[model samples]
Target: MRRRGPTRLGRAAALALAAVIVVTGCTAEPPPPEPQPGRLVGAPAPLDVTEVYLQQRIAAMTLREKLAALVMVHVPGTDAARIRSVLDRYGFGGVIIMGDNVGGPARTVAGLTGALSSEAGLPVLTAIDQEGGIVRRLREDDAAAARELRGLPASAAEQAFRTRAALVAEAGVLINFGIVADVTPDSSSFIRSRTLGESPSAAAERVAAAVRGELGTVLSTLKHFPGHGASPDDSHISIPRSSIGMRAWRATHAVPFRAGIEAGAPLVMMGHLQFDRISPLPASLSPTWVTILRQQLGFDGVIVTDDLLMLQRSGLPEYENPLRNAIRALAAGNDIVLFVLPADPGSVGVDLTGLLDALERAVGDGRLVEARIDASLHRVLSLRRAASGLVEPYVDCGPKCWGESPRSLALADVPPTG
Candidate 1:
């Protein structure tokens, strides 16, 4: 009864006070929403301009032409003429050089690259795995020449890596420095000794530092995505499996990859190991893993698969067919497929035609999406143009290339700092 007595006046005063509070709060503004884990909040999105140009290019290409881009084969021996013929016939977009491909000096490799690029009428991505330590391919018999510099404390490792990158770039081939090898490190681990320590945060930081340090000297590729450190078996001989769950993976193994992506690493190499919690397929063939990489990790670069032939030879019945594996990799978001000759001596028969036919059929059957193909082709072309300056065109030093002029040496020594 007492409250009812002052109803009208009191009610009016209370309403006015409520309005004032609302206005003041509105002007102050609420705090910004907290970003979710793995979300790319402040990062710039990958440009779509390349995708548009690539679509137009692919639309004009024939089935055979598209198939050629999908296959990246190894060149046997140092015979430049034979390599050139293979490249010209297929219009191959790139070559993965191994020990067999390194025949002569820096000048010789440059000459070979120039010849292949000229005949193909397209800038080619000539790459090598000159990862230091036992993986070094360019130098032989000089153990000091192939120094293992992976696991040095971050600062020293980065400087040494930059020097290594500069040297490989000087050799006239783009490099695939093995930034990450998926082997798990135990208490007495020699392999993990090269890795950036056990913690994912530490690993990611070191890898990103290496990428940033090598920015202008060479193109850096972050390999074996989705955390290869957990794999117990070697993919080279068997299909390795990681017992860790997706949650554990996200917290640990995935840390370095996310860091590398944030640093704008131009290329990411997919691993061949399988994670059973997410998908039965290997990371190279799993859409969840690839989609997470592109969308969540904010990586919009070329994704190349670990060699398909290795999967087939891994003693796994499921990987017996390399063509099917290639198709799966494409569907899973990988942009390139590597087919290299085995290190085993006296091996014959590569079966290139079979691989080509399989890829062709996959495209025809819609197993490999046309849009995805265009996206990948555009990335490849962009990388080629960026690396070789194909669009601008530099001096084509024909045969008597070395030391013809001091100017030539000056030009060659200046590295492409992208």
Candidate 2:
């Protein structure tokens, strides 16, 4: 008893040590097994189609060739030879023609489109923002053209939009880029006048009409989703935030987006605005928004971002560099990331090589699932096929111009709806 009493301190220390060991053992876990390489999972296998054919072609292409395909550059002037060189040098997926590109509307369009397709062996997706009112990209002095197009009240905007879509299809552009369609009067109030109507329901109806009109000739893209209407700032200048929460967003901003998708619009453009309620990232790089657009809304169409380079200029610290945003956008389920005319031609803002490299690295490192890549690629190609028609053998228009061709007249009747 005496010896036990004398040894009590030692026994207490031993018990304390045992407790510490037990706690340590309980807290310890084997290090997680090194993650496996990225592999496709939870995504449908690649489908067989003309798109796969093109992707295979792209896959076989050199990095420069692939980079070339990703760009849709603006031509300096109507110089067909210079434009041809750009096409040849870049092998671009398309050309975006602004007002500056037009000389004689019919001649310029036919000549440029023909050159890109025939000489370069690239079927270009010629695109323009032809939304009427102040945003119209196509213009004509003809009274019929002006008379055919009229700006309707918000209540009648749907019918007007349908008519506008029909007119856009007649223009021979493969893609009709709709601008200010998603803005409302109340939120940002900056894009209010450009919007068809103040109410979400009205906007949705008009958007649907626009989609319906483009079913044959051009694929319609309803832009600035999750509502740029709420932002006071232009995304081109700054990353605007929405004061409305996700619930309000679902009720209002999401209305037109749902309508456009339901109308079978093949493409939707993600906005650069940030929605803190949904995500800290810009809507263009948010999985929540993209997932809603794809799964919740049941939109199977391609999701393209509103110019990553533009977002970089908007003073968003995270998005100051576009390469990160590009990777994030694709990861967030955007099929195509547009880097529309960068301020710096030499820099290009987003490094194409860096973007591909990051994607490749993510695939290698198991961060990005291969299935996701394939899904995006599939959607992109499907849209491309839908946009492109049968590849006719090249006929050099040279000086004679394809505008004189009978096929070009098909666009003449496509009247503008103001």
Highest lDDT model number: 1
Candidate 1 at residue 26, lDDT? 65
Q: Write the per-residue lDDT of candidate 2 for residues 68-119, one digit (tens) a residue.
A: 4444556656676776676665566666766776666554466655565543
lDDT by residue (tens digit), candidate 1, 294-393: 8878888888887777787776788777778878888888888877755442352246667678878988898987777777877776776566443222
In model 2, where is the ten-residue run with the lowest total lDDT? 396-405
Q: What lDDT score is found at residue 222 in candidate 2?
A: 82
Best model number under TM-score? 1
Q: What TM-scores do the predictions have?
A: 0.75, 0.70
lDDT against true structure, model 2: 0.62
Number of backbone collisions per candidate, in order? Answer: 3, 3
Off by over 4 Å in 1: 1-56, 119-121, 140-151, 181-183, 187-193, 342-350, 390-418
After TM-score superposition, what is the CA distance of residue 378 in candidate 1 from its true location, in Å? 1.4
